[model samples]
Target: MPVLIPTLVFRPVSTQLLVTDGVRSVGENIRDALRTHQDTKTLGCHVHEPIRPYWPEDAAAQSDRIFTGRYNGRRFALNVTGGTTLMALGARRAAAEHNVPLLYVDTDNGVIITLAPDGSVTGEREITVSVPTSTYLAAHSATVSAREPWGKAIERRESWLKPFLEAATVLGQAGGGSERLLDVIRPVCSGGAAGPAELPEVTTAEESLANRLQEFGMIEVARRGGSLQVQPKGDERIRQFLTGHWLELYVYRACLTSGLFDDVCLSVDIRRRTESGTVVNECDVLTTLRGRLAVISCKTARLDHKDENKGAVYELDSLLQAELMGLYARKVLVTNRLALRPPLRNRAGLSQIECIWGPHLPDVAQRIQSCLLPGRR
Candidate 1:
């Protein structure tokens, strides 16, 4: 009997019944994202969709039909966290009838609350599942194209990365020099570098910008009397950075070095196709912290109209749309070399957007890191 033996290991199978509504792709996208999740893939478990967007009575009936059909014997839990109020009401009816546990997600606090089948709170559970950036986007029915060249090089280019951060610091400390420099140099460097004869005469603030970058070895500058000359060094990337690309890199590098985020992307192009046409949303920096989505917008040039910063504020606030990234996303607007006055701050605050401006922008990396330490959060 001890000569030979055969063994088998069987893991429990987990299944989910997703409830969607007539709203849009919100429910479909969530189901699709979950179907593509790492666990469901590895375990070879299948995702089945039997219920579609329907009225309250139809929704409850469909749920009941499925429960009494093939999945009758399987243990179940109902998540009433999302979907339309009617859909939730129908799901609640089915849950009560089927005697399944109910759940509500507390997104801000990062926990899932359990409830009795009748819908009263029972207890809370931590969010254990991990969601990737792509999955998060897919959950919102948005897809991300390839990232910019700067993104691929973020973690690999420490030598260049360090200097860029240092230069950004100098930009903030140099008073209004950073903006003047970006505004002037961006156009000159964008379509290839312009001839020296075509360079604009430097204003006092602009001249300070040129001088500070010179000290950081980013460029060589010569001033004769009141005339200013800028000789950009290094590769074409250097010129690209001067053309408002540096601010993106600055904010990205700060997030990357903070080590607080699990995934960091720089200059992501988000596209969503609709009946009208394809819409594009260009983001400066996109990251995820504890499975939550964050969109950071960087501004090197003034985008205000009539000295009102509402233009920039609205652009950042638009990410909350359901067709875009959704309301759960964290929005941040970081301005380099320019101070965000009280009006801008108050406007951003109203939208729950974090505004990091001027010199304060330079300390973001440290701030994020500090929150990671024990008792700091």
Candidate 2:
């Protein structure tokens, strides 16, 4: 928890890094990342020339040189939190030689701690700076290729989308084969893309749900005795919403209105270049809170503990690892199910991922706030 640097007027040694790198490519990426960080450009940060050193001895020498050779007489502080042990040792030696202050970010409490020349706590200040999703991903060595904004059109439709979600809750609890029907209907709505479809046989629950959806203008349905044929409304976005995107929009709205998150993005596509090849990931809903990444995966479809939902469970768990959002990320899997099956809940629990169901989604923001600020009520 020693990597978050907030840009504050009164702080330890002003915010910036004299980046150290064993690999020049990685060092350049770091510099680029900081240069493009949300606040770095506007608020300003001091970016020193990169120090390339492979060995501890070299690390100490070059790090010292960065301060002494060029910027003599200017006050300096050494930050040793992010780099390797060898680098930290080198940095410590350099700090001692120059008699400069040392500092590291305290990620756990979202604070920065500065050490005096004696290594005692000189000052610690809370970090109130916010980082966007792109900056967060870049810190983990990923780049955002593309992302979809939460549109104003969607905002205008929130009131219109409410009834269908309410009906979703009621029909979700209905007995009979409604879940299977929903699985079919969603694809049909997506596949048709505002076109007509002859739906498969639906039960009383499904028929009721479909009819309610039709009344909500989600689709157009004509009843022919026992069979049902459907057509989506003209709007493609609305069709997408009817096909499980509603959950994502609802969750996004919850976070936005909550005013707790630093940044929230929907449908974010990320790319990370690796030695093997280019790696890619897409987040349904991505956010940063309390100096930690939080990824929320939304599901309007039914989920049960049995291997049926195992892929979804593991995919969400995977996002919490270093390959993606990093181990420090807060992971949450959200579902329209009023309550998930016990085993599924336990599976998510093993990864410490919080699951929010339809009934409790009204408080999703509160739940996120609680996770980010666990000490608070």
Candidate 3:
């Protein structure tokens, strides 16, 4: 039977230490460990030629043995310098080249050491000693402390698993409108991080759940300023929201309609008085028929999925918004998304406001045509 090889792990202390101070500090830590446990005797460490005989000239030299330290009869090897760029690669290369007993690796420190048959490192390199596989294994094991050598590995695995559950919760809470999902995602989406190419692994499930919320409609995503935005293939509202050039289309369609005016002009900030005695400044889709002025206020909402009552809430808000619109002018809400409010089901009789709902282009164009028909006036 083949012997099951013990997995090698790099200690987090050394990993963090290496990132902060290079490999030299890791070597020192190993040396301290040896002196605390090993008996008294002569100590020597075989380090890369660049590390030996430290001098000012050697400061810029690639010191291969930044972590090599002598402590009692045992020797500790730490690789500090060359690890800046080619870290584990350098150590692995060194092991392959030399027939020494391979052991623990301090990937952060960039150190490789030879060991004896019994997995002990005496005072010398592998040249004179009969290096054993166990020795290499021991060296590898030494890089991690016995306290919790596997902690980082477990943490890494956990980091990758959190996103799924979080995504499900965020999506379920969405109430079925893409726009609501976008609203939740907008606050969290940093154009800096969520690129199309690489979404990062989130630490907690909640963070992952937020990312899942990102795959909503383009108009909603665009409204929120997200980088990884997507929309339905025929979603024209997304096109209008992104381009900001569709107000003219709304104005032109209103001209031939009879609902309120004959002479139509898009008002920038037309003011009107409401039934509740509040004055509101609004954009007026205006027209003059029989020398009377009429107005329409446009309010739009993209969809947000998961909140079934989202439409009802939106309908209520739209009514309130229309009352605000009615304060100064008649109101019309043109939305590509399905009408969320049940009370506003038919545009035929909803107080004094009109709700236009259509999905595809022809349907939307017709709805706009219906809202703007001059006969209604």
Candidate 4:
């Protein structure tokens, strides 16, 4: 049998590591990760250590050592699923030197990629690995306890929000008619206030539009004294549907519809300890494609703030968090606002973040697909 050599890296999950057929690991972290996930049960597990992952020479030396001894005569394939860039570079050198094939798992596209010894793409073969959601979440260090199954949650939300989202789009376009109705209901839906005593009188034309919103089950009209009372459904679902969470759900649905990702997580709560204390970072959406990570931040509110520096600061902080996830992970901001001020845009450019906004919001799946195309990022 051909021997598979893989470099080890720090990972919260072992989906990628387990899916790739290999025996190579250069660190205790990866070895433990694989063992905890039970990947070592089916795949060959070879653990070696004391090699520097960030030094190309050290990584290359480790690869050389693995190739020596009893394993010398077997054909070798380098699987660069884990490890640092230095380790990848060193492994690439080793592969080229031995004229062996290089393999990589593209998690996003669910494909096994083959590269010639010279680092040229040779082929891509699709794969199906049965990885449970709980296993995947555990690998990523996410708190799976008390968390709803993402697929079930998504299915429930999609059914509940379909008509609500359609109404929102119409309200977005209908201007004052929509605005007035929202004003009458916002207090009831957002705050714990009772329904408004009376809605502002509407023109005959606007009255029909208001009736349509009621017909859509977005609100209920009741008579109070000598006037019409407007009461929006104040359930938690409605509150979330009306807020930024709606946009987050929209983006998540779009990603699901596109079918371009290997795995997707919505509202992933990641906790990490800092010098001060433990902090929780909630990502709107996290996706893996073609073995790269994509961190998407969805904003329904305006991107521009009166305080010029505020928006830039927020985007910068988000970008920094994405960088911490992985070196080559894509950082993206998706917003329904028309545009961000030039400063914020410039900051995004400087940080290598892809901003999708305005009209592009409707075509989010296509836009994200474009970003994931080979040679784009």
TM-score, one value per model? 0.73, 0.74, 0.27, 0.63
Judged by whole-model lDDT over C-alpha atoms, candidate 2 comes out at 0.65
Which order, best to worst by lDDT? 2, 1, 4, 3
Report backbone clashes per prediction.
Answer: 0, 0, 48, 6
RMSD for all candidates, in order, please: 8.2, 5.7, 29.9, 7.3
lDDT, candidate 4, 214-324, per-residue tens: 787756676444445766665676655554465666677777767877666676665543447765666677665544556688765545665643563465366445423
The lDDT, on a scale of 0 to 1, for candidate 4 is: 0.56
What's model 1's lDDT at 324?
68
lDDT of 1 by residue, 259-334 (tens): 6775677877787656699788888777765446667777777645435478778887776664466645677777
Q: Is candidate 1 or candidate 4 better by TM-score?
A: 1
**lDDT scores of the candidates, listed in order:** 0.63, 0.65, 0.32, 0.56
TM-score of 1: 0.73
Which parts of model 2 have CA positions greater than 4 angstroms off?
4-26, 42-56, 145-216, 219-236, 374-377
- Deviation in angstroms for 86 in model 2? 4.6
Q: Where does candidate 1 have its weakest 10-residue lDDT segment?
A: 1-10
lDDT of 2 at 370: 72
After superposing all C-alphas onto the true structure, candidate 4 shows an RMSD in angstroms of: 7.3
Candidate 1 segments whose C-alpha is farther than 4 A from its true place: 1-21, 42-56, 152-217, 222-230, 303-310, 346-352, 365-377
